[model samples]
Target: MDLQQLRYVVAVAETRNFTRAAERCLVVQSSLSHRIANLERELGVKLFARSSRRVELTSAGEAFLVGARECLTAADRAVADAAAATGVVRGTLAVGVIVTTAAVDVPEVLQRYRARHPDVRVLLRAGGSDELAAAVRRGDLDIAFLGLPEGARPPGVETLALDRDEHVLVVPTGHRLAGAARVTLLDIADETFVDFVAGTPARAQSDQAFAAAGLARDVAYEAGVAELITRLVARDLGVALLPSAFVRPLAAGDPELALVPVADGPRRVEYLAWGRFNPSPATRAMLDVLGVRGADPED
Candidate 1:
């Protein structure tokens, strides 16, 4: 009936509990219940089926929830637009970044953004490239920095090439292979390797490199985070294939770690992804700061 009633229904649908929804909405449980009841009465349909132990949405409620959430999102965007018109970018921007990128430049990016627009709020989450891509597609992330799969394009998001990071071999400085100028895949095929988990873009690139060299790797360990893999290699657990940026900080501080270039390998490409439709002005500004632009004039 009204925005307030719709807000109450949406909150209850999300939390699936009257008390918890009321708490999140910053209202008393009794008031929230009254509002929801009035809304259901006006609509002549039950939104939620309730019992002493739990609650569940009715079929109609499940269908209505999507529209309710969209309405609230549009309302919030409208407010954000008005604020931007007054030279203030004030809204929550959810950003997702891969593990390595988060460590490399994300902190500096956020610091610059905060200094420029203190009113804008940012929520940063870290995950693997696949997970971050899924969040961007699901509208959970306003933008993301992730490795795009080879020949894979996101459904409703625009992609811009950010930067390329070369794959390299990471080992303890005292290891025999550490002195090599450029190591080929065959050189380490028999060595115990720390590998990225399968089904990720990084793994795909690494696999392609091995396949190109007419070799196969013996993976002794697998990890999700590059820094963790580096730590394992530092402890002499196993050598790892990692991006150049991921090894920079550790190589600077720890003299025992050696990063050797992998010759004749495919470079890892990082992409800046944002929803194609309904991107906020604040998001565009951040992209400008990230130095992403349209295709080069020569192209």
Candidate 2:
């Protein structure tokens, strides 16, 4: 019925706990519960299935949440529009970033944008490429840095390609293929690998490349960071395929690590993306300050 009730519903749906949702909305649990109960009574349908173990949304709640989130996004955009009308870039800018060098210089872009438009408020969130992309699509983030499939465009969004990273094979100094000039997935198919955690961009790319070559790799250990992956390689745990930039600094610092290029390697392209419609004022300022082409030029 009201924005407060809608917000309570959304928070509860997202957190799946009334207490945490209330805390996030800066309200007491009882008040939030009462508001949601009133909303359900007015609508004459049960929204959440309550239990000792968990909170589950009912069919009605699931259907309502879709429209509820859109309502909230529209309300927030209205506020952002009002702020922009003052001809000064002000109000919140929610930005999400993924981990990698191939992505645009997030820190640099924020720094310059803030220097130019001190009135703008910036909020930063970090996560994997897929998670950030989902947040952007849900209107939870104003813009995000993401590592997408090479040349793949996200639906209903405008993307700016920043840079690309090439995958390379890393080995230990005393390893048999350490001195090899270049190799392919087939060349290293027999060797055990120290790999990225399953479902990560690097791991997915590695798996896809090997699958294309009709090779099955043996993963001896799995790590999530470049540092750990290189540390395992230094111990001769296994060889791995990582972004060239990730392997570069670590290989330079550790004499035990050898970097060999992957011929015809899989590459990941990094992008800065935003919704095609109704981007906030602060988001626009950031695009301009970074010289990034956004969804609209006349805004």
Best by lDDT: 2
Candidate 2 has which clashing residue pairs, if any? none
The TM-score values for the models, in the order shown, are 0.86, 0.78
lDDT of 2 by residue, 5-65 (tens): 9999999999999999999999999999999999999999999999987998999999999
Model 1's alpha-carbon lDDT is 0.79
Alpha-carbon shift of residue 232 in model 1 (angstroms): 2.8
lDDT of each: 0.79, 0.81
lDDT of 1 by residue, 74-154 (tens): 887898899889888878788988876722388888888889888888998988777887888888888998875345544
Off by over 4 Å in 1: 102-104, 149-156, 293-299
Give the range where candidate 2 is weakest over 10 consecutive residues by summed lDDT: 290-299
Tell how far residue 171 is off in model 2, in angstroms. Answer: 1.7
Clashes of each: 0, 0
Error of 2 at 3 (Å): 1.2
Best by TM-score: 1
For candidate 2, the per-residue lDDT at 115 reads 90
